[model samples]
Target: MAGGRIADQVGRVLGGRYRLVAPIGTGGSAHVYVADDTTLRRRVAVKVLQPALALDQAFLKRFRAESQAAAALNHPNIMRVFDWGEDAEGPFLVMEFLEGGSLRDMLDSGRRLTVSQAVLVGLEAARALDYAHRRGLVHRDIKPANICFDDEGRSAIADFGLARALAEAAWTEPDGVLLGTARYAAPEAAQGRNVDGKADVYALGWVLLEAVTGDAPPVADTTVATLMARANQPIVAPFGV
Candidate 1:
């Protein structure tokens, strides 16, 4: 009920320009709305940070930092951030509204791409990551869920440079949290050690492995076990890769 109330900003206007039209998606710390850009007269996505995380001083810092990092990048294969703002409800970010669903959705529906097919998707994703790495930013989260497409079947990396900030906000949850999903987490990230672009590279590698094999990596019941596996086990190469 609480989350629903906050997310019910269906008709609210943000930045005096974007009007929230409907709830499109939700994440641990944010609610995504398909909104109308009144000024541009176009559709856009507005991701509002849940009230609690928005109110937390530490999380807000990371939030702004991540927003800034993502907004600074321009790549064909990265989700494009347009603007950000705060209101009585909390902080929100604006981004391009994509039409095609996530890669994860396709895989769950038994639509695994062939190795050659996945290579094209992988190349686009890799290009986005490389662009961020060159700019001193890291995606921190690289999974099929974060890989989205457009109406044209083009793939792009979502939350390209904000994983750190979002992960940091999630850390303040009642129980602590890991920065990214364990199934695709990099070894250093699973260990809570300092990480860099290489972490994203590692996670991307795992994602591609799953893409080719049509096998979802084992996600342990406990975060601890997941961490142990990523940190201790050497990943098997994808079949036929």
Candidate 2:
């Protein structure tokens, strides 16, 4: 479920502007909804932070700061952050609505992309990552779920979240704790070492591999196992890929 009643949040208005229309998706950190931006007279996606994260003052502060920075990012392959605000429930971000779903969705359907298709998607995402990196922002989390497509079949990166902010804030997670998906994390990220844009590149490589293979780069069942599996390994693209 999204977050208890949070998933049932429909017809609710936030900041007296965004009217939640329907729950679109859910992730560990937030629930995303398709909302109507009354002021802008357009449909937009609203990502509401989980109630637990919302209650943490430290996270809220960093989240807001990061959101502002992410919003400033301008690239065709980057999801545009139109606005952000807080309400009684939690802090929310208003963003461009992409109807093509995510790479995760496609791979989950058991259909793998062709080599050409995968490369195109990877190229677009790489461009977006490079742009963000040049601006001194590291995504920290780069995986299929964050690689979304628009109605036009163009891939764009989404959800530049607290993982990046927390890293920059120098806030440490307890040992063995992880921020993003372990399957896509770089060795440095998995080991809780300092990371840069290269980490994003590493993760994107995994995403592209998964895209063409229709399988995650072999990891074990447990989170720790997954982390250990890749922590000291080299990335090997499958033959002919």
Task: Write model 2 residue lDDT over 1-241, tens digit each, in one string.
Answer: 2357865689999999999999888766568999999998999999886555556677778888889999999999999998888877777899999999988889888878899998898889889989999999899878888889889999889987556654544334434334337778888877878889999998888888888877677666677877877887776667766
Instruction: Give the alpha-carbon lDDT of every model.
Output: 0.79, 0.81
- Per-residue CA lDDT of candidate 1, range 1-241, in tens? 1666756688999889999999876666667888999998999988887677656777778878788889889898998999888877778889988888788888878888888878898889888888889998888878887898899988888876556776666444322234236778778888889989898888887788787788866766677887888888887665666
Where does candidate 1 stray beyond 4 Å? Answer: 1-7, 170-180, 237-241
Candidate 1 positional error at 197, Å: 1.3
RMSD in Å for candidate 1, one decimal?
2.5
The TM-score between candidate 1 and the true structure equals 0.89
Error of 1 at 113 (Å): 1.4
lDDT agreement of model 1 with the native: 0.79
**Total clashes for model 2:** 0
Top candidate when judged by lDDT against the true structure: 2
